[model samples]
Target: MATLIVTLSRLNARRHATAPVAQGSQCRTETIPMPASGDLVANGEEIVELLADADCWVAIGADPDSSLATDGTGTARKLKADVPYTFGIQDGEKVAVEAA
Candidate 1:
């Protein structure tokens, strides 16, 4: 199976903060497993039913003081950020699935 490196970035950072993927994104020295896409649909056709804003569950909880909050919680305390995931598809099926 293929592999992917998912990363996150704090959009509310006062200074320039991003991940390596684009900018301040994070890239581990090792390859990690693919995370749950939060996609519970059995098929793509049913995606039409999950049009609600909360239908797609993204991030939750908080960022904590060790996270971006180290600088200042201001807005980071609310776990505000962006999730940019990477993956591949072969023959219309999602490839590079990681083991649970």
Candidate 2:
């Protein structure tokens, strides 16, 4: 099975609460922030497209306090070394960005 991990570029406060509902059982709930309009990424293709087009790239596992920009303007962050991930590329895939 394929697992998808989503992270928001912006920072928001989230809350997790747990309370006892019955004599022994407990209830737990978490509140997360929702992305604004046109900011939701559905699949890998969409994420790839967004990264390809983004002038500013901010990933979850990037360098601390660093910004990566497509243009020759900003410093891009790097993914941390602890997390493991896999990237797939298929034939007939086109590269959209060009060298400056």
RMSD of 1: 16.5
* TM-score, one value per model: 0.19, 0.18
**Candidate 1 segments whose C-alpha is farther than 4 A from its true place:** 13-30, 33-100
lDDT of 2: 0.25
Per-residue C-alpha lDDT of model 2 across residues 1-100, encoded as one tens digit per residue: 1112322221122434352112112211121121111223222221121222222222321221224466766533333322433232122221111112
Candidate 2 Cα misplacement greater than 4 A, ranges: 1-4, 9-72, 81-100
lDDT of 1 by residue, 1-100 (tens): 3223323222323445463222243221222233333222122211111111111222222221112334543221121123333322112222122221
Please estimate how well model 1 matches the true structure, expressed as its whole-model Cα lDDT.
Answer: 0.24
What are the lDDT scores of the predictions, listed in order? 0.24, 0.25
Sequence-dependent TM-score of model 1: 0.19
Q: Candidate 2, residue 54: CA error in Å? A: 20
For all candidates, what are the clash counts?
5, 6
How many Å off is the CA of 41 in candidate 1? 23
